[model samples]
Target: MTITIIGTGFVGVVSSAVFASFGNVVYGLDVDEVKVRSLSEGKVPFFEPELEELVGKSLSKGNLRFTTSYEEAVSQSEIVIIAVGTPSAADGTADLKYVKAATESLAPYLQEKTIVAIKSTVPPGTNRQVEEIISKHTDKEVSVVSLPEFLREGVAVSDTLHADRVVIGATQEWAIEKLLDLHEPLDGERVVMRPESAQMSKYAANAYLAMRITFINQIADLCEKTGADILEVIDGIGFDKRIGRHYWYPGLGYGGSCFPKDVKELAAVSKKLGDENNILVLMDHINEARIPVKLNDFGEKIGGWEGKQVSVLGLSFKPNTTDMREAPSLKVIPYLQEKNAIIKAYDPKAMDEAKKVWPSLFYANDVNEALDQAEVVIVLVEWDEFANLDLGRMKDGGWLIDTRQMYDKKSVESQQLQYLGIGTV
Candidate 1:
């Protein structure tokens, strides 16, 4: 089936490439001409595991194309998917301005029997909101469906291609049937439900994950106080078949695009409905207040930050992606900076994006360069490159703080570096 996806950012472009790669004529539409042209020329705007290769293959097969015009995309495809960003507004409600704009632009182009699907993470009832907008604008009886995305940035291709489950949310029987058939190429379990329930499920998943991260982070602090290791603690509880072990590792906090926004929006939505479940608000509280356990350990030994040279490793929220939105490093770096500490930071891919936030912030070419002239080093993210570093060349004090616990402290000490890992011995 032919599909047109609007707003080719992280979600739009990846979904387009993956769909086109497998077997589909996908038109990627965006307002940014530069972005469309760049994608048209096989230039991916951001990094993902195998997205560029997939896009290239799809483009070569003539299964994928990009454009800036809504008419061009909507006219050529049988289904139009709103894959635009629903970034958080000031009050934590999802700003649907982009989704609204995309829907408005698509109104005139929507023909009779055209299926309009929303593939973005939005608040509940958004499908109806969009459907009403289309109803007011066009006479065509468009079938709107909510197929909220469950994509993780680093491994989006695999997530889309091998999704555990695909939720088909629509009142129209025909729309649900077609969406199931559309996703039949991928072998995800088909879960058909109402649009509102599917939308809430997306938020629920993110909220639960956020709670788990915040829950373990609190435990990590208690571990230090009780002379216990958080790693061993996780090991003891993780093997329980019922509990399982995913998103179980404690860290600085949950960040990037999804969890922060979704959890906040869910809390906001729930508050408006009634505060029966205040867990969402608490999850946000704990995550935002969650401090790096290793940072505190380092602070004990390395005292004040006045005129101290601090090296910050990993700027992105997590590894393999350049997204720094709501990254913990944003909080940590500023805390150090405010203490009059001279900071130098480095990341494999996030340097350019990080520079946008702190343009004058000192950056190094590599880990070695980042460690150059540093007295204390803080690992905010767990990239593989940092884990495989030659620690022997580190600062003379041997002060290394590992927030992700990505390195072995026993081996780190052999390199004449003092290792301070979160909840590790």
Candidate 2:
């Protein structure tokens, strides 16, 4: 099968590379000529661990190629996947202008009855909108389908290769067959459903995960006040067959490209459906509430940082990916700056991206440079390199706060440094 993917963002790039590796001729399309050209040179644009190797292998085999011309890709492929960006709007709805524009651009060139699949995170009824747009411009009978992606940022490549399940939403049986044939090489069950339900499923899954993290963070606050440890409470609760363990670990908060936007988009979708969304509203507020929760905890630990040198390790939303969109570090860093804290931070790959947003922040050359002359160290993001940092180098009277609980308290205490962590004694 000749598969062509539009919008070479994180999802588009990762999915195209995987599809090519599965023995299909894949063409990745993007508006950015520079990015497409970089991929053609076998260089990945983002910092995803091991993606360079996979992209290199696929390129070497002539299975994968990148191009800025959407018309050329659409003319040569049987399966066209729309993996564009659906950024959040001011009204909390997914701004689908980009998705619509991409569909419109390719509508005239969609030769023969090609299967057009949407992998972008869009609001419900978007596939119908896409179908309407395509039918208005072309006489070709296009099979429009909605197949939302559910890959995490850090583990996107692995998740795509070995997905838990594949959801295919189509109106026609042949449309379903086209999608099934595309993913038939994989060994996972295909879930067939209506397009609206498929769209709702993606938002529902992300909102529920956001709610879980918010619930645990709220309880962690209560545990801190009531002299109870949250880890023991969570461990005890996790053993129950009813409540499985995942997304239960308490931390700064949940922040990434999906959870925040999807929750708000779902609430907007519900409002359009004429029903109030209490749970989703609470999830958004609860996730936003952590900005103060984190800053207040830092203030309490460092005794009101006015002119204090604080070192923050990790800037990305999570480990293994250089994505800082809606990351907790952005919220916390600015708050510390308001209190007149001299900030020094380091992340293996996010520094270049972080500098674009936080130009005034002291960019450390490495973990040691970030910690130099620091009165306190805060592990903001759980990057693996930070899990074994040298705590003995911390200045006298300084402390370490493990917000992600990615540290060894015993080892730090043995080195005579005060170690504080969430849900730790």
Candidate 3:
């Protein structure tokens, strides 16, 4: 299968590499000359585990290439996958200008019976809109299929190759069969559905996960007030197979490239459809308020935030990725700054990206450097290195505000430090 993936962003690059590694010839197309050139040289623009290696191997195998020209990439392809970013518009709807542009650009170059798979996360009727856009530009029989991606940023390569499910949303039998055959090597369940359902599936999945996080965070708040431990409560509820234990993490709320944007879009969609009162809207509101609320609580526990040397551990949203899109650190760092706290931040891989968003803040060379002479420490993202931090490096009687609940309270106390975790008595 010869494939052309439009967009050189996270999803496009990963899809290109994975598909090419499966023996499909893939061309990664992007408008940015520098990014296309970088990718052609086997360089990934962002930090994702094992992605550069996979791209390098696929390039070496002569099955993967990168280009700036749509004609060069899309003309000879059997499947054109649009994995462009559908960033949130001002009205909270998905901005589909990129999707529409990609469809228009590729329409003229699409071969007869080509499968145009949309791997970008979009609203329910977006596939139909893209199909209409394609119809306006070309007369060729191109089948637009809603092939929504479920790749988590940090482990995108693994997720692409071994996804939990591969959805093929198309009306044409031939289009469905061709897409299924293209994804035959991947180890995931095949879900065949309508385009709208496929699009909604991606939104619904993210919204449900966001709601779960919101639910847990709300419970954590209650636990803190009632002197109940959230960990024990989670353990107690996890035994019931219906509720499940996974994704019940109590933290500074859910923040990433997908959840925040998807939830907002879903809420906007619901509001536009006359469903003004919905959980989606409330979930987003609570998630947005989590950082400030938690920070205030931490401030009260630590005797206020003024004139303190605060060491912030972890900057990225979660871990193993340098992406800071909608990360909790975005909210956490600024709030501390406004409170007149001297900030010393450190992350394993996100310092560079974090510096871009927060250049005024002091970035530590390492964790030890960040902890040096620190009066208070705040754990934002749950990176692996933070799991076993040496609490003794901080000032004695300093506060450890564990927003991610990464550190044990007893362990911090052993080091003569006051430990504060979410949902813990």
Candidate 4:
């Protein structure tokens, strides 16, 4: 099937590539002319390992294409996937301006019997609202489907290839059937649920993961006070088949492109609906507070960082990607800077993007460069290169704080460095 993916953001670009690679002729549309042009030239705008190669290969094979013309792209495909951005608004509700705009633009072009799938993470009932809006503009019967993509950063291509389950919600039976047929390449159980249920599934999945991370982070705090290893405790409980071991890491809390924003939006939406006492609200509060764990640790080691040079290793949240939308490292970096600490940071991929937000801070080229001439080294994101760095040779008497537990003490001792990992001495 020919798939037209609207909005070449992270989800759209990755989804389009995956869809096209597997025999589907995919055309991805974006309003940004530069992005579209770059994508056409097989230039990936953001950093995703092997994404450039995948996009280049798909483009060369004539399976995947990109364009700025929404109408042209939508008219050429049998399935239209709305993968646009639904960023959180200031008021805590999802700002659907982009989704709405995309729907309006594609309505006129959606004349044929097409399956319109909302792949973007949106608020509940957004798929229905989009269908109603599009129906009003076009006399044609459009099959709007809520087919949310649950792709995570760093490994989105793999996630798409091996999805645990695919959720299909549509206005008509044919829409769900068409989506299931299209997703035949995906290895997972296909669930034919209602549109609203499908929409909420994405949010619920992310929110629940946030709750798990927060729960573990709170437990990590308890472990710290009791002088117990959170990792060992996690391992003991993780063996239980009922509790499965994933996203149960007790560390510097969850932060990245999706979880933080999605959790906050859900909490805000619940509060607006007078469900202020919701447990999700507590989860959000806990997740938000988790951002300060490293800062508190930093203060404990070296009371005030006034006039101190602090080195922050790893800027990208959770590594393997350059996306730093809501990375906790961003919060901690600036927080230390405000306290009169000169910041020197290094990341495998996020330096360029991080420079935009923190241009004044010193950007180091490598892990050792970041550690050179620093009083404290804060491990924000656990990049593989950082995990095996020669810490002993890198720093002398510097406070080595590992927020992610990315290293073992013996490894740090081998490098002649003092190690301080979360929930570890």
Candidate 5:
């Protein structure tokens, strides 16, 4: 099957790479020529494990190509997958301007009986709008199928190729069959449903995960007051078969490309349709408050931050991706800055990306450099390398605020560092 994926962002890139690796010819289209050219040179635009090798193999085997032209993209493939971004609007509604524009652009080029699968995360009823837009622009029978992507950012390649399940949504039976057939290369159970339901399923999945993260964080907050270990608390309840052990660890609340936006969007959509979304609204509220709450606790621990040389380890929202969207460090760093703390920060990959938001940051070369001469250290993101950081390098009696709870309490206390963490004694 020849496939053309529009909007070569993380979702699009992973799908293109995976589909191409399945021996299907994939044409990844994007308006960014530089990014497309970079991929052509075997350089992945984002940080994802095992993607570079797959993309290289796909290119070497002539199964994958990238271009900036919609005409070329539509001409090369029978199926066009929309993987455009749906960023949040000011009112928390999903901004679908990009999705509409992408669909309109390819309408003229779509051949008869083409399947237009929406891999982008969109609100309900978007598939109908896509169908109307494309059908109005051309007489070609364009099947707008809602095939929302469930790939997590860190493990997007595996999530796509080896997904536990695949949802196919379309109004027509032919569209459903075409999608299921195309996804045969992927190892997953096919879930067939209407477009709106499929769209809701994607939002529901993210919203539920976001809720779990928020719930854990809230529990951590309560646990601290009761002198309870949050980790053990999680272990006690997480072992229950009904409640799985994923997304249960409380950290700098859920921040990445999907959870935050999708949760807000789900609530936004519900409210827009004249329904109450108290749970989702509260989930968003709680996740947003995590950083500020942590900052308040950090300040309370140190008494004041007027002259404290603070070091923040891990600048990215999460590890492995250069994505800093909704990163807790973004909120935490600035909050500390407002409190008059001298800040030094470091991340393995996201330092460059982080610099855009925090240009005033005293960028550190490494974990040791960041910790040097620091009176306080805050582990904002849970980077694996930070788990083994030498706390002995820190000044004696300095503060160690482990927001993600990445370090051992006893080890830090033994080194004369005042250990501070969420929901811990």
Candidate 6:
């Protein structure tokens, strides 16, 4: 299969590499010339585990390439995948300007009977809108299929190659068969559905995951007030076959590239469709308030936030990636700054990215540097290195605010240090 993937972002690059590694010829197309050039040199713009190696290997095999010209990439491709970013607008709707533009640009160069698959996270009717946009520009018979992606950052390469399900949403039989054939090398259950259902599946999956995180956080809050341990409660219920134990961590709520924006988009769409009291709206509201609320409670626990020397570990939303979209550290750091707390922050992979957002922040060289002389130490992201941090490096009586529940309370207490964890009593 010869494939052209538009947008050299996270999804596009990963897809291109994975597909090409499986012997498919892939061309990664992007309007950003600098990014296209970087990718052409086998350099990934952001941090995703094992992505660079995969891209390098695919390039070496001469199966993967990157380019800025649609005519160069799209004209010779059998499947043109639109993997562009659909960022959120003010009203929480997916802004599809990029998807529309890509469709328009590729339409003129699309070969007859070519399949245009959409891998962007978008609203239900977005595939139809893209189909209409392409129709206006070309008379060629191009089938637009809703091929929503479910790749999680930090493990996108693995996810793409071993997805749980590959959805092919198209009315045309030939289009569906062509997409299935293209994805035949991947490991996943093939699901054929309407375009709208496929689009909604992406939003629904993210929203459900977001809801689970919010539900656990809400339970954690209740546990804290009632002197109950959230870990024990989770264990008690998680053992049930009906309720699995995955994604049940009680933390500073859910934050990443997908969950927050997807929930907001769903809530906005539901409200506009007359379901004003949707639970998704409440879930998003609570998540938005989670960091500040937890921070205030922690401040009260450790005397006050004023004049406190705070050390923060981890800056990315989660581990194994440098993406900081809606990360809890984004809220945690700024809130501490406003409260006049002197701060030193450290992360293995995200410090450089974090520095872009907060240049004046005192970024430590390592864990020891950040923890040294700190009055309060907070673990925002659960990176592997933070799991066994030396508590004795901090001030003897300093507080350890474990938002991710990464440490045992007794262990910190043994070091003559105070420990504060969510939903722990």
Q: RMSD for each model, in Å, please?
A: 1.7, 1.5, 0.9, 1.6, 1.4, 0.9
Give the TM-score comparing model 3 with the true structure, all chains together. 0.98
Give the runs in model 4 whose Cα sits over 4 Å from its true position.
410-416
Tell me which of candidates 1 and 3 scores higher on TM-score: 3
**TM-scores of the models, in the given order?**
0.96, 0.96, 0.98, 0.96, 0.97, 0.99
Model 3 score (lDDT):
0.90
Q: Which predicted model would earn the best lDDT?
A: 6
Quantify all predictions' global Cα lDDT against the true fold: 0.85, 0.86, 0.90, 0.83, 0.86, 0.91
Per-residue alpha-carbon lDDT of candidate 3 for residues 1-425, written as tens digits (9 for 90 to 100):
89999999989998998889889999999989999999989889889999999999989999999998889888899999999999999989999999998888888788898999898998888877887888887889988889999999888888988899999889899998899899999999999999999999999999999999999999999999999999999999998999987778898899999999999999999999999889998998888888898899889988899999999999988799999999888888889989999999999999889888877778999888888779899888888898888777889899888887778899889888898999998
Question: For residues 1-425, what per-residue lDDT tens digits would candidate 4 score against the true structure?
Answer: 88899999889999889888888999999999999999999899889876888899899999898998877788877899998888889977788999999998888888568878888889888876887888878878788878887888998888888999989877587777778788898898888888889889999999888888888877777887898888898888888999977667667788887887888889898999999989888887777766665576658676677877788888888778999988877788878877888888889998898889878778887777787767778888878888676554354766777888777777766665667777665
Residue 220, model 6, lDDT: 91
- Cα error, candidate 5, residue 55 (Å): 1.3
Give the lowest summed-lDDT range of ten residues in model 2: 416-425
Q: Could you give the candidate ranking by lDDT, starting with the highest?
A: 6, 3, 5, 2, 1, 4
Task: Pick out the ten consecutive residues of candidate 3 with the lowest summed lDDT.
Answer: 384-393
- lDDT score for candidate 1 against the true structure: 0.85
* Tens-digit lDDT string for candidate 5 (1-425): 88899998888888899989888889999989899999988898778888889999999999899988899889767899999899999999899999999998988889888999998999888988898999788987778889988888777788888898999888788888888888888888899989889999999999988888888888888888898999999889978989966667687788888888999998887787777758998788878877877777778868988779999887777877788888878788888889999989888888888888878778998888888768999888778888888887888899898988788889889898899888788
Candidate 6 lDDT score at position 288: 93
Candidate achieving higher lDDT, 3 or 4: 3
Clashing pairs in 3: none
At residue 334, candidate 2 shows an lDDT of 87
Over 43-141, each residue of candidate 2 has an lDDT whose tens digit, in order, gives 988898768888999999998999988778998888899999998899889999999999988887887879999999887788889989999989888
